[model samples]
Target: MFGIKKFFSKEDPQQTEIIKLLNSYRSAIFPIGVQNEWISSIEKCKSQYRILITLPFAAHSQQKQLEQYLLKNKIKEVAIAIETSIPASYKFKEIKHIVLIASGKGGVGKSTTAVNLALALEQEGAKVGLLDADIYGPSIPSLLGLVDEQPTAKDDKTLNPMQKYGLNTMSIGYLVPAENATVWRGPMASQALNQLLNETDWGELDYLIVDMPPGTGDIQLTMTQKLPASGAVIVTTPQDLALADAQKGIAMFAQVNLPIIGLIENMSYFNCQHCGEKNALFGADGGSELAARHGVPLLAEIPLDIQIREESEKGENLIAQGIKVAEHYVYCAQLLSSMLHLQSAEASSVEITFSDD
Candidate 1:
């Protein structure tokens, strides 16, 4: 069997150069903390070398760039394998990362972004889950076309997550009637969210996206402080009011010491289908400005497209339908996952201890 150690031991200059090149190559999309040990193994097969690399998150989008980079270096007959794994941490063992999708207020398409981003991550070859934490207004059931479906009990204490589009999902809407409004107080809503989160039998997942109810209120604070979330992604529009609320959301996360992964600006603009011109319906670059001000990456700027609204209304996934705008969601998922991986890497380097003085 061929291995990195043995390949280096053989003293083959060509093989050594290949390994050196791979170690030195940095993915443009990957965060700064990426290490060279990502190259898991290397083997010679039929005059071509097959290289297997492991990462903390799925990055299918960077495969082509990596291949092109290697090709440019005259490493023509090289095969690449990209695999992802959960980082070692005290965070949920079963779930690698719990990402909160939040907004300052409702109507910024937070739920839609959550659902589509979950699907996009799955599309990028990661095991993903979606948990609709919106107790007052759960839209994931409607968004995933599972409004009428209920999750089955795995045992007396746990309920199996409903599966759709290859995603493990659970929502409050699945347990309660869709039309009935949840008239519970903040603590009660927070308790229900806790129950839904703890009682669901979500199998090992690369990412579990929680579509949080709009705002930076009690429920949001409860989730941030309690859950072992890896990070958060704030969703907003280009409008001033939404941007203001987004700042509040960012501030709230900072107060709780939770990492803000990035921001997604939905309904950023509209494109005239007939004239092929772009229009800033809400406002121009508000999301970008907000992200820049907060020192967070602007993950994506989703346009105000009729197709997105219509498909979401019909409980359809744009990525499933191969819509053009689906690319934006995929890009967001890729960048978000990369950020989470980087954040985890950073966390793993730090050491914390507790002592009763």
Candidate 2:
């Protein structure tokens, strides 16, 4: 809890008004008096006030809204700090949330999206880790330019995650030769995934983004049941065939009672560099329609850009470089964090009390 008295007088009229406004704001719930840790400081100089706040989750949109509200109320300046909070987890106590990135079928650029999303979240000031859960065809190592790298053992029991671009990462690709075939049974593959997830020493992560294997199959079901995931982000192209498969993925998570964070439509369109015209190569609005029908947010409609492909092949971090398409990835990451916080808050709101007389 934060000490309000240190920053402002209890009887100050302006302070009181500001507190009321923050608590009443629906998008960014402050509850300053109770969960006062959200607020770092409040200072006043003449008629102007400067406020500093710290949020548990990334809420850039809400922060913008808050700034607008304060300015409208004649406040001179406002700053809201964002940080990652360790929400309760069913397992892996060090991790706050486990998010699986899945798709209905392959070739939709799910792995590439997962890599960029993880990097985007890190850019938003969260401690993030990436796990390549695609057993048979692990691509994270190659995607991150870590194909030759290997993870070291922290102890006899656990292995330290390989660090690249500030992300602690793990994948079977690190252990096996890329040229060799992973010929194994379903149970064997599942066991390998379990070991990779449980045995890695992911020290205190805000999010562990698992790049799940494409499709709704045995491995997918095994992970959905075994891991206490916060939710899943379904990645698909804006096409009828891809959308149909995406629906099946959604249904699988729903049947297991796992939440769907949202949907991401990759390869949504192509913007001609020469003409500056937007081309719907695959199709348009398929992702939005699917999301609307399922009551899930359409997180992003990533444009079909050649640079995105080129960079992925070279294992480069576009967000770090501040590329044009990086904005879309960052927006998706911000929304993902904000939606997770909203969902958690909504779930915690429901309480049942029992009385025995």
Candidate 3:
């Protein structure tokens, strides 16, 4: 339904005009991945045209660019709708979507990305939850300023999730002291993660963002097999070492038959506070090249801004304020939301019936 072939079937001259323009229009994420891939659809109401565009990920700048392109082509009184498609392992009753924020190795800013992304989704008008599944290094508590808060027991088997910045959250940090070491074996850690995931009252969430532990080890593998994730977002820096690890992360997900939503190139560059110059601190376009090579979207390239670091350390995510960094997160979240919607639409089209146990 999203390819150029549909437009040829229509007889209207204006339909033909739109089709010609769209043929030249390429998506930043899914460019040339599939032949005749129709990124947008149209519905006519009276004299106006309503176009609905579905993306593999979100980019606000791209949206504006497309609108401008259409306008320049003399398409007037056209309304555009943006949507996304994300793949899922399975659906959960309490949560509509489960997104894993993952990394192949440590020190890639995975936790920080997860925190900001979760808050950004909430800011973009979604009921969001953050799950600190990094058993060894649970940082959501510290990131959201919930280190002093503890969960209330809902029952013998379940605990209530803590609330902050309009997000429902659960973390291992809330259960243990900050300085206490987690001397947990693989099985013990996995069991604890399971309890935190299923034995918590998450209520009804549009998305439950899971901050996965680093590495391509037992914990990561177990979570991929166990969690009902809609998709995963890999976080990596622009350095060669980080990209190499990110490939392993992508491969691990592929091995588990998990779909990748996209890759977030965190700390891609740094902005000079005084001169307003952008310096490629790590490297240039490593993430973009990786996404291009792998046929996945490069969701966002977040700059290494001092404010982003400062606010995150203070448990005040920049996205919660009217900050510039927040805009990137908002676009990323919007793209993710569109992908999730697309995945849901595709899944629903293939209605299946399972035998009741």
Q: What is the TM-score of each candidate against the true structure?
A: 0.90, 0.87, 0.77
Question: What tens-digit string does per-residue lDDT give for candidate 2 at 32-95?
Answer: 2213556667677665666666666654335566777767876555565444454554346688
Candidate with the larger lDDT of 1 and 2: 1
Which candidate leads in TM-score?
Answer: 1
Model 1 alpha-carbon miss at residue 295, Å: 1.3
- Runs with alpha carbons beyond 4 Å of true place in candidate 2: 1-7, 10-37, 45-48, 60-69, 72-74, 78-80, 86-90, 179-181, 350-357
What's the lDDT for all of these models?
0.83, 0.82, 0.78
Give the per-residue lDDT digits (tens) of candidate 3, residues 65-97.
666677889987667665543333337766878
Residue 356 in model 3: shift from native, Å?
Answer: 42
For model 3, the stretches where C-alpha displacement exceeds 4 angstroms are: 1-90, 179-181, 347-357
Q: Rank the candidates by TM-score, best first.
A: 1, 2, 3
Candidate 2 weakest ten by summed lDDT: 27-36
Q: In model 2, state the lDDT of residue 12.
A: 79
In candidate 1, which residue ranges exceed 4 Å CA deviation? 1-9, 12-14, 350-357
How does model 2 fare in lDDT? 0.82
